[model samples]
Target: MSKIVIGKYEGTIYPEKGGYTGALALGFGPDGKRRRLKRKGRTRSQVLDRLKAAVVDLETGVKSPANYNVGEAVEDWLAKGLRGLDDDTVVNYRSLAGKHVIPLIGKVRLKDLRADDVGEWLDGLAGSLSSRSLRLVHAILKRAIRQAQARDMVIRNVAELVKTPKGTAGRPSRALTLDQARAVLEAAQSSRLHAYVVVSLLTGIRTEEARAMQWDHVVAQADGEAGWRPVTADGFEHEKFAIYVWRSVRAHGDTKTEKSRRTLELPGQAAEALRRHHARQAAQRLRAGEEWRDHGLVFCSTTGRPLDAANVRRAFRLITRKAGIGESWSPRELRHSFVSIMSDSGVPIEAIADLCGHSSPAVTGEVYRHQLRPVITRGAEVADAVFGPGKSA
Candidate 1:
């Protein structure tokens, strides 16, 4: 059952919800029949407010065509291709549309949306987001407009013609020095979870990739001539000991990149740590008996599902704190530390990039350049040796 009411200042052509829980629709048309606005409100007050606002805009001749409304356009665009995107990507797009774009410029006509309006929106978004995220937002809007053009709603996408605003510098990353890394590992000695920190710092694998590692990816021992080798194509041979990167878990997507699909030589310490980890994991599996899921992930929950990224981060914080380091550090910093330490050892940039799964040396250079400043200083020391120490010409 529902109640119907006409507003004092504006006439309503549709019924309002009677219950206090759900929303009601207050729609109007010139012919007095429902106009099919296709809009619903979350509350009676919201519906009334929508009606009042629409009336005011119409009276002032400021209302755009029903098809031109930005909110409606976003809804239409979403219906077209939302299924193709990942769950997390779709969630973020919906959030941006609802919280930022819709609240700010939803009333603007799709055809009327100018570069200035988009620019103003982006300007407002500055300082609140990272440069990377702002770029994503710009990309989302541009795609939305392209979707609109495909439907023949707008002649051109103003978002395409507009420049995206620059975003603020995100928090700077600080990698742990060798001493600090040792301290963290020492503190992690009591934790079964130390295996996570060990692999991250030692291998420089991305968090997601590390989360996806399995026991099958590693080869501990091999007989004469048939040295330890990773499983490749359902066959095992004495391949190089470093060729064990082939057997990653079957996640939804491919490995980060073709380049990321690489095998790296683990340090002796890392190899020993992984051996101990495997032993411990086997014991736990034996204890669990039939209760274990046996997903075979090197790092996983007791039930064998992927470990929650948030839980890993929280555990990392605890490990860092016990190591007498500040908790402000992030798990990604461990990867940075790996790159920094290797670069300091005069490892070639390409080699470091390959080990870290970077797409290219350029990508690694951009992110870890500050970490490699010592490399330049070392180069200077080399130059000083060649040129002879500190003497004015």
Candidate 2:
């Protein structure tokens, strides 16, 4: 950055346009090297106004050094900015900065950056990112730039002046039909994850919720006239099995949300699966002897260690492929399938929402709109009835 000077400097005055001549100010930088600052405007007054601001910046020492590059600033923030945050969050932020932000404009000097540079960088990412992912990338960049601005590293945050372009849509959530769900469950009967699959698909429990399950959470409700079945149902006197969704394997071993702590009655198949799985796990524990960890988790490996995501996913895919279901499905989609199945069976939306542990009916309705298609058809039906199909027109 150039120091403020007292005298006018020589510059070219263009004759083609009636405006302020392009001008310059001559001075010595902090390093004692000759420096020239340039400016132009639609009018001499406009040009002078900018020159005045530059002069103030130089006098007050607001101008940052031109040598500091974007890479240094972003790396500094990544190394020092994140404190007291979750380890997973730090890892994700670091990955995003390294993979997306640093490689592109890391070499550009902070003083040389412009709004257009930020815009072009984000626009180029549209080919590889989804709209949601682009927002995350933009947020990381904007936050890093803000950190620089707060410390007087840059005059302005160029990233804040740009908008992220909408990129590709994210993956569409899919649910299996009842037949496909049944097939997968049947195939899982031979796998170690049989109980986990049965609990998730039949009860609509979250994968995390299921992973955090303990044997103690499984309860047998005493048989009343309407054990778990409604008073009007034929099997009113049957015994009921339920699982208390009181915890998950989150950072603190808590459920995802307050409402997510629910108690759901399990179907007979899920109950039977758990019974068989408990016996199998006990046998494995004896065979492993002292190698068993004994976390008391309902789902575990052969040595009684708690199950991880990779374990469940591999087992899930294996059963899915065996059942002739597509190999692309995830365990979370079981909840979606549950919502769709209940919606198709004419269960009230609020009832389904309660079963799924959502905060409200609206939340369930919004997230599972694909499952609630039957309810939405009423609007079209009413419109058709009112207009008589537009035949009169």
Candidate 3:
């Protein structure tokens, strides 16, 4: 309950109390509703200044009585300010608060929270988490504190005064050699999933994009020279068989990027693999009958449901182990191999960039340079010719 006190002037005022921080919730005139006057400044004098301002405002009929907490401020911010953010981003923020921020300083009075408190919290965070994670924690807290200030709850946002730790970068990626890639494909040949592997390597599409492919996007109509059609007589295109990449499946949602949504011409080997896999999947669908989902996905489980990416990874690991290929690799490695092999084969970087749907050759080079280094070295042979016979430059 708010305590009512007559203003130094003529008006009666009710000032609410007991917030996350020190506050002065000033009420209004006799007939008018209450007005909240909180101190957002960190210093006592600052809080008093805010309180005095609220008192004057109440005397002048300016604002309403308001007193809120850190928790309340967070809820309001999430509801009103975070509406445009995606579900995953919201979930992540909530998780960060629950796991790290709230437990430490949630009980502190919004107005009473000090820079020292925020700094201590960050110091503790540094001991257990990566610099990046700590920075995230700081960012979340800073936003929450700023919101509290805007709401007139806190005297100051301590998070603003604290410094965030620097973040760490991960090691560079390692790509597979030509022999290793061939070995992986050969090992994958006997599996029902062989076509998927071939397409991933040949097309350089991400796993999610590859998995999301539908039967509608595979064009088989040779307009004349060398282009695939939107659809074929057998239901999809490609001489080897039907294939498509119309939609991607994600655990939380869909494809990671809008640009990843694309269609491409399937190579003969990949098309054949798809033909065989499609046949096998069709038989399974026939057996399942009413139990099948019929998602129309080109790559799916026996009942037409999308395969889990995690399950795909595990199976891929098994295939590599069986192939006697020891170096660590993931499905993405094949995408790198595609770029590498294309570059080595003398395909213009621009053309390869288009084939891989890369935004620019620079990005393609940056990502696959580990694999494309050999091409760069071989191109140096031109320098050898210019400099005279057999001179290593």
Candidate 4:
């Protein structure tokens, strides 16, 4: 063995088995303990090169082991980084990571991962995924790599350098026409989900918000200057009603946003349906007797348990089928229909935004762009009056 010096560190190169091995004593670490670096190669120069690389890795603070891989990093993040998120959200992230990220580049070593590798992975997924899904999966990888970087598991986030490629267009959201909306409302008249459909379609509240509604949140106009009282209040009767959109089925039972915590006056149809629903629920409570689990939610199963999205969806589809519309419709579309009906009635975008609990009209315009009528018919009418009707050339 011969002593070799590289920078301030001292090491020796010696023959081991069929290859040369280099061992270096790098000074004490922050823990006051000696740190050593070792490398093995077929030749002295190769061993020296590896030892130099190791020295650089130690200096740069990127000492991730050669075997630490992207899959491990993603799983680590899924385990730790997703804390405090909703259960459904955590499940969704894990599902996306398992399906798209792990299967594609999970085996790639974190140290060796490159921007080109990430870009190529995204390009490969472009054909199979929608643009939104592509962005979500890309964000998952970038965040996972970021988590690893914070732990010194990798030098940099390679996933951040790669641009998310465009993917296939997703299915565009659809709104029911006036005739269809009317038919759907009429069909819901006989179903148990009548009030659910009416409140969702007319009030533009999220399905989660609708399900989380409590009996206390539903208020009726009070006598004189008293304002309002809960519909469940003794001797309550009123022509006008309103609901406090103060909660949702999301984690912590919070609304989607601060602005989403609003109060909306109920339409005649919604208020009437809710009144009928309350009466029906009383009968249901009597029937269930001791079996009812009184959550006080405005909408619940016959057992008085809060209704889940699957319950709403299944019931909504049956109503849609009875309305002569296809069963492909979802409950979320009722909110879209609310925006559509409002826009078609020439309601201002700002007013519609407020009703939908949007932070701004821009959100309303962008999300429900297809349903909004932005063109001014007055200009055409004025032009027709000024220039008369011109013949086509």
lDDT score of model 4?
Answer: 0.85
lDDT (10s digit) by residue, model 3, range 1-393: 233233542222233343223344444758798755445444444555566666654555433234445555566666676665654467677887778887776766555567888888888877677787788778887887677566555566777888986545534455556666667777887875687887787677777677777766665755343555444244434343324444555543455555544556565666666667767887998899999998767778778887766567777777788778763567766777777766665666766666666677787777776666333322212212322233221
Poorest 10 consecutive residues by lDDT, candidate 2: 378-387
List the candidates' TM-scores in order.
0.66, 0.68, 0.62, 0.80
Q: lDDT value for candidate 1?
A: 0.67
Q: Which one wins by lDDT: 1 or 3?
A: 1
lDDT of 1 at 43: 65
Best by TM-score: 4
Task: Tell me, by lDDT, which candidate is best.
Answer: 4
Q: Please provide, for model 1 over 1-393, each residue's C-alpha lDDT reduced to its tens digit, 9 standing for 90 to 100.
A: 244443434233344474232222436668787543223466656665555545544444443454476667776766776775544467677877777777777778776688899898889888798887788777767877788777666666788888777789988988888778878877887886777787677777777677777766765335554455543322323322332454333335457677778766555455556667767777888887888897778788766666776678888888899999878878879888877776766667777777777788899899898886433222212222322223221
lDDT on C-alpha atoms for all candidate structures: 0.67, 0.74, 0.63, 0.85
| Model 4 worst lDDT run, 10 consecutive residues | 378-387
Q: Compare candidates 1 and 3 on TM-score and give the better one.
A: 1
User: How would you encode candidate 4's per-residue C-alpha lDDT over 142-176 as one tens digit per residue?
Assistant: 99999998998878898888889999998888998
lDDT of 2 by residue, 1-393 (tens): 223333454434332256654445466789999786655678665666666655555665665554678878888788778876544467778888899989998889876788898889989999889998899878887887888888877777888889889998889888888678768777887898888887787777888888889887876655553343322232223456678899887667778789989987776667777878877887998999999998988898889887777668877988899999768888888888877766665666787777788999899988998886444221112222322223231
Q: What is the lDDT of residue 135 in candidate 2?
A: 90
Residue 376 CA displacement from its true place in model 2, Å:
16
